[model samples]
Target chain A: MFAKRHVISMREFSREEIDSVLDLAESLEPYARGGGCDALSGKILALLFFEPSTRTRLSFETAMMRLGGKTLSLGPTEGSAMAKGESLADTIRVIGAYADALVIRHPKEGSARLASQFSPVPVLNAGDGAGHHPTQTLLDLYTIRKESRLEDLRIALVGDLKYGRTVHSLAYALALYGADITLVSPQTLEMPDRIKADLAGKGTMVRETHALEDVLGEVDVLYITRIQKERFPDPYEYQKVAKSYRIGAESLAGARDRLIIMHPLPRVDEIAPEVDETRHAVYFRQSFYGVPVRMALLKMLIGDRLE
Target chain B: MNDGEMKLRVTPIGNGTVIDHIPAGQALNVLKILGIDRTTQATISLLMNVSSRRSGRKDIVKVEDRELKEEEVNKISLIAPGATINIIRDRRVVDKYTVDMPDLIVGVLRCPNPSCISNTNEPINSRFIVKSKNPVILRCVYCEQAIAENIADYLI
Candidate 1:
């Protein structure tokens, strides 16, 4: 059961476990389309976002509510009991007794792992600095299947591959599914070495490029991510590489008409607003998949019975 | 010479090597990898989970007979670089030296990155560029993460 497990890295999920979630995702897609099912009745999800989150938190809360479940939210470290010098171990130890499962997001890289060590309930990683975000990757796999009708389609992951934990997780999963991926990011933001080797060894055709426009036409999915301006230690360094690449309305003209453009959302001009109206833009649907994917995850984890 | 739980128990071997000061729990893994554990006639005294005076806990494997191979010695130096080796004859220490890095490491060290092609499902022996021996750096052919040394719980 996911309730007893701790998700610190994407590697924690074996190929078989990912398939189980994918099967659940396929079965639960109808409920996402508003089908009749109370899969999460009598369950409670605990949200402990130690960092600020606009989309991730909302998606989990909505998923729980849609499943006829209740949630207890504790947002950001500044205002929470964590600011008062409470350790994550203590925080989760107390919260675990109340909530059946924990959806945790913290800035520390391995905060999710540390929380699960003490908590009696299962721990789900929302975002843990630049470490790993397994939940988002699951939704991404669902989105790719729903949008492209295949998992092995060519994808060009653009912008901030270094610090973008979402892309890191997604790339590993894509490699596992035998997808051809071209990583288009600045040299400084190139895909980490370990990730590149993993993909290439599995015979996934991967290339590193500084320009997204040069490789734009060859991809079935154009995954765009912001520069993660918030993660920079120096503001000027952030300013320099902030807008190195952008997937605007003009950029999509040359793309395959059926090509899907995805972002984890809350974009800062990396994707233009006009692009949202195009048939290619699937960020909203990308966001929507979060609910069912998470619901399917929660169901498989803590089960249908909400504690 | 005395076989104590924590001390490096040196046996009266006719001729052989004795590895001392290994961090507890690492000796068996090293011995297994070196094929010493599979010896049929050789008497093997493997003290494990033993407490260390320096490390708070450690282990020592004392072999009664049979000397380790030169390549095996080099591999240990390359992998378990911190371990000390002693060549003994007639129950007397003849030569003693710490394991040093080998010039060319074929399939010795496993890259710390799980996603590295070397660590994939395929039966591939990972080749290392071996950038820096001091602070070990290995560039993966498949991935960019040049794993730093000391990342492994046990090098062997």
Candidate 2:
């Protein structure tokens, strides 16, 4: 169903399509772990990242490599033609000629959709500023499906909800799976009413709370996010608020043993390092799930030629 | 005629378009969408809050020498969904029809999100998917952000 289609937004995927990707990712986990596959032999994937990303870029590259496909990157923005004032459309058009599919991560919202319009090959949005990172959302779903069941599970999305693009897309996907969601954030960072309203329309049972500890005990999954200091006007206020949101061992005393903690990583003090040793920490494995999830996507979009 | 008589008598347009049954105060917005400003050479007349038998109160815009374009008419449908377009030639109504809101509104309205790629230097026109008709909700085809309220403010 994903053949040659642009993966720009989570809104584009229905429940069946999301389930299909997760199922495919489950099948490809063996190759993602150690084995090699020539599903996309000789295919070349292009990466154009206007913004800096470590895990996303690496996982995408690794996913392509594991599939017996080669990958090329535009490298740093300062060194690429983009530094010379080339538009994203021109760059996509030029690079699309050399690749089977294009993965773009830009700071501008809807940049991937614009690139798709100009690109000859399919376009996958790694991320666009405060927009969508469908691949991340997919991998996140894979992680949740792997560690814990999606249906009827209580998932609390903590930290920055208003500005955190990861949580925004993840929330919608979780709601689609019929997971009861609890939004834990500072009042300033509460999930937008529009998003909550949309979730409610989907028949999702949603709750909003300012304290993470309030819902940490009952939730099946604790999704923590780093409170971005840049989003706040006062640094002192950020430090104070950031401290209250930190998930440490002490904070998990009342948490259920089955409760798994997941975080989209490169985390800055949101999930305490000490908690990494706990049985609840699936975030490290969660980060690794990106490889297989992305592998499933790359194969679906461009693997037909090899067949 | 004095100011009082001028206010009482609304002039008819010759060889132009008459947009009647506008939602009362939206006549100015319709004019704005048609690019009728101080620089416009056409004789434009906007009658606001006129008593209407159908909708209680309505507005009308008469352009003496200009007819509205397709894109302009579509944008007018956003604010004045029930507005009727009357084509006037030689001071007589030649044709009349109600504006139909297209399923896809393209190049007519801007994406209100400042960070939207359409607002950037990309070589593309602004596109919105009409999600609702009665209230005129538009979802940006690119960003997927909904424009539910104050939609006319985003008209290009």
Candidate 3:
């Protein structure tokens, strides 16, 4: 059912499909870690990053390499036709001709969805401007499934809930798995009303709070996101909230023994370095899981042709 | 006044279309959807808050020498879901039917989101998935932005 499909939004995925991807990722962990397979041997995966990204781009390349597939990249937009005012659709069309599937990260919201409509091959949205990053959500669910349990899981999504697409996608997917959600963010950066309404419509039990201390002891996973200064209209608001959202060693003192902290990283100190050595820090492992999760996604999307 | 006298308030069109049962206060919007401006060539009659047997009050539009296209009929459905179209030819009703609201409305309404791909110069027409018909809530296919209010303003 996944053949030649566009992975554009988490809303597009059913709970069963999400679990299936996570299950496939678990099975492919050995191949991802060991690094050799002929599953997608003859396929070509294209990487297009209109926005700068490290983990998403590399992990996709890593996933493709592990599956024994060749990968090509449109490295920097400055070096590509996009710098010369080539439209996203035009670029996607050109790239789609050369690859089996396309992994795109654009600063514009819905650009990935738009690219999918134009491209000949399947489009995997690495990240769009506060729109979606389904693979990240998938890998996140995978990490939570590995470290904790998804069934009746209590998760607190902290920091930048307003603009952080990671939490937005994760909240919906987590609800699908029947996890109760605690949204922890400053008033200005609280989760959007539309998303909360959507979750409520799905009958997901969600609690909203400004204090992380309120839910820390109860939640199985503490998901912290970087308060993106780039997304804020005013730098003062960013500065005010960024200073208040940090988590250090003392922050976890009241937390449960099995409480796992996850972040979609490029962290500018939302999570202090002191927390990294602790078993609670599953983010690095979370980042590593991006490989197998993406490998599963890539295989699911385009591997049928390889058969 | 009697029902026949009430119907005589708006003159009949010889060969055009009559839109009836529009929700009161939406006659201007229906006219806008039909692209009726001061420079419009077609002779038009608009009646707002007229008495209706089904609805308490309604609006009606009668256009002379002009028939609405399928696109216009669909746009009218967005603003006036209960409105019916009567095709007039030689002062007689040739065809009559209530406008059907399509599940997917394409290219007629613009997405309110400024950042939506449809709003950009992408060579793609805007598309919306009708989530609710009574209240006319539409979710943009490209950006998934749900537009619930003032939908007429977003009409392309």
- Interface CA RMSD, all predictions: 12.8, 0.8, 1.1
RMSD of each: 11.3, 2.9, 2.7
Q: Which segments of model 2 are wrong by more than 4 Å?
A: A305-307, B1-14, B23-28, B35-59, B63-72, B89-94
lDDT of 2 by residue, A133-199 (tens): 9998999899988998888878999999998878989988888888988999999999988888888
Tell me the lDDT of model 3 at A140: 92
Q: Candidate 1 lDDT, tens digit per residue, B1-156? A: 224622344335566777777776777666755666464577877777665556766676666666776667666554455777778788788888877666555565665665343453333455455556777665543233465655345243
Clashes of 3: 0
Q: Per-residue CA lDDT of candidate 3, range A1-307, in tens? A: 3433889999999888887888888999999999568999889999998888887899999999999999999978898998888888999999999999999998877899899999998999988886788899999999999999999899999998887867888998888877889999988888888888899888896899988889988989999988778867889988877877788999889999999999988888798899999989999999999999999999898996555
Ranking of candidates on lDDT, top first: 2, 3, 1
Model 1 alpha-carbon drift over 4 Å, by segment = A1-4, A33-36, A75-80, A228-244, A304-307, B1-147, B150-156
TM-score of each: 0.67, 0.91, 0.91
Error of 1 at A226 (Å): 0.6
- Against the reference, the lDDT scores of all candidates come to 0.73, 0.88, 0.88
Residue-level lDDT tens digits of model 1 in A127-170 = 77656788889888889888895555899898888778689788
Name model 3 segments beyond 4 Å from true. A1-4, A229-244, B1-10, B31-58, B64-72
